[model samples]
Target chain A: MSASLPSTSPFPFPRFYNFPPFFSRQPTLQTHHSQLRKWSTLILNYCRHHRIFKLSLIDALDTELLYNKSLDKRMGIGEVREVVEFMRKEGRAEWAGEGGKGVGGNEVWIWWRNPEEWASLFYEWVDDTAQKHTVLTLYELTESEATISQEFHGMDPDLLQKALSILVKRGKAQVFGQEDQQGVKFF
Target chain B: MSRKGVGLAAFDRSRITSAQYASHGNSLRSSHSTSVATQLSVFRSLLQQFAQTHAKDIRSNPSFRAEFARMCAAIGVDPLASSSGAGGKDGGGSFWAQMLGGSVNDFYFELAVRVVEVCGASREENGGLIGVKEVKDRIMSTRMEGSSEITDDDILRAVNTLKPLGSSYSTLTVGPKIYIRSVPKELNIDQSAVLEAAQVLGYVTVSMLMINLKWPRARAKTAIDDLVSESMLWVDMQCAEWEYWSPGFMLGTGDDG
Candidate 1:
């Protein structure tokens, strides 16, 4: 979904996105640090709108994704790897590998917003609905929900469910499975 | 006279003239002490004036800072303390080290550069060779207590280094207090460059440049020889003097031995 965003550049140098330094990790602290901050902001915004919770390092290297002539931007393997590593450090994503082995050459979640943040966002969405004690189906909580739409803005229903699971861990909500449907009982 | 009479006579002189003599001698002694004190006071005030005016150039350049530090240390004052007082701010070794090419103890060459850089601008103000005494006084002010034994030759070496590739200057001898024929100002270049280069090279000789030019060998030789005879290119080491002859130049002590 992000790759298909109309091939337009919002940054000052529409061609700068294609610059090698844009993708390569910088070593100098004074220069590289600000670059990292920009990258983090760009990725986080992209993730929130797309509801992109997971990003595969392999998939990011897909020629269609990074090297499409339409956007004219391509990231090397190392750059893709570095961006994902940066995301992981911010707790916005993690490896889905077996016993953390996936950290090396791992697939990552693009938690443009971390689960904790998403959980809080979910709480706000639930409160705005003014249905504080009501239980709602995961599908109902995400799709056609007025407050959820306002907050997540077309967030994937599945990723929304994952975000709610984080809230469940914090005793902010309870989840129950009945038949083939799951429901959230919010505090 | 007998011992008693001599004593009586001495007492009588004390009554009539001893007080006057004592007062006169005391006043002369006091004035003499005041003059010595005044010399020291004036010298110190002059140092403070110099340091205040030139400390920035002296401390900012690597070569100057090191040489200045060495000069301070040579006179037995701590470089750090003197620099801080002169700097009038929080001073650090890093500041000195950076200006002095990374370390304080690099060698006399580095110190020479620092000295040259620091003094280069001030050279004009001091009247070049004519102001050698000012330079000497500036250097001497840093001498340690109980060790005011710096020689005129040592001071001359410092001053001669300031004489450019072609220049002359005068210096006074300590013993006879005579103005010996010091490096005369006929070489035609500034002394600051010479001093700076000498400080770096430890010693340097001025000779005709070997580069091919329109001048004939004889003319160049005569020109260089004339300059040398006029005491223009003076080096502390007498051996470092030369004359250019066409393809090459001759280097040796020219029997001023």
Candidate 2:
């Protein structure tokens, strides 16, 4: 069990991470539930620590997040996809779209911070930046030097749109854009 | 416990000395230590003769060996410990422990370890549980140096010795049969009662649980499903009746209708 993974891993892998059977889906109900729960937590924590906003099944395997090359053990793609789906059900992640990176299109958008939490953070940033009642492109909100120190900088565009939509629903911001040019004006 | 076990030394000596001489004399009371010494020699020879003559029977028959063990216990002699060159005075029984296959306790202890190993090898399927009879069969099949008269009693005795090691090994009773568990998972009362009903042919179904335990459909399913998930019982979904058999168990005690 002492066989360790790459020291570069974002999160401290659990002790059972070295157990060979750790990757195999446990057939028993209680054991299976516990395994899924632990895997889901590990996935969330890993992505959050590495500022990882998107994770497809293929990239996850190569990153040594779902597979341990040292132990020659890996969670099958299907098993990993199931864990992502479980995270989605728990509101910790969301499907990227009707598409995926790998064959099955099982790519998922990992949401380290749920939309509500991100929206509140964005609203705070806008308030502190004197951007209230001023129009700003989606790019300026996430990419500009004004928001460089923000934890949510370089956010996924889809997630940025969702965060703005939350402020829009409360009449705190308004979104207006053409087909390729999008911008939001906070009120 | 060892106190009571050693109590037989004085009692057995007095009886043997009293039986040989019918004379009522104060000398017998005065020479108590010498009388005990003479009686011990007589008793040792008698036990030695018994072991030499019954050596074959004890080796071939498990029940007879168990009886012999009981008698040894009655006289405060351990069939296993007396042979390890440990017991200083009761030395004649060392041959008995040897004749019965090199310390009965050692044989059984070895078997107990194997039983747990096999049961735990496939934890996902077996839940570290194997039938007690299956344990006996596996031990008998193994070609050990001595003591081929392996029986369920020996298995039970060896398992009892493993109890102090922790909950890793234990004997579970289901109806008239026993199952050995090499893990510490707890079995709730309802789950136990469900297994108890399964002793008839080594299996149970939801319908069987419903009828035997007089349970509602949901109640029966919950208990059976718990057992299945725990791997304490196996499910045969292909069967029309949905049989849940605990493999490597099921010694029919004729209680089944």
Tens-digit per-residue lDDT, A132-153, candidate 1:
7898877676655343435454
Candidate 2: clashing pairs of residues: none
| Correct interface contacts retained, every candidate | 0.00, 0.08
Q: For each of the candidates, give the backbone clash count.
A: 18, 0
Worst 10 residues of 1 chain B by lDDT: B244-253
The interface RMSD value for candidate 1 stands at: 29.9
Candidate 1 to native Cα RMSD, angstroms: 23.7
What is the Cα-based lDDT of residue A42 in candidate 2? 78
Candidate 1: tens digits of C-alpha lDDT, residues B74-190: 756443433224343335543333333333323322333433442343332122222333334434455456632333333444334334433333453322232223333433332
In terms of docking quality, how is candidate 1 classified?
A: incorrect
Residue A47, model 2: lDDT of 75
* lDDT at B237, model 2: 40
Error of 2 at A12 (Å): 48
lDDT of 2 by residue, A1-187 (tens): 1221212454666544544445667657655555677688778777776667777777778677887777566788888877877887798877776533333465677777888898999888788878888888888888887776676777878778888789899998899988447888877
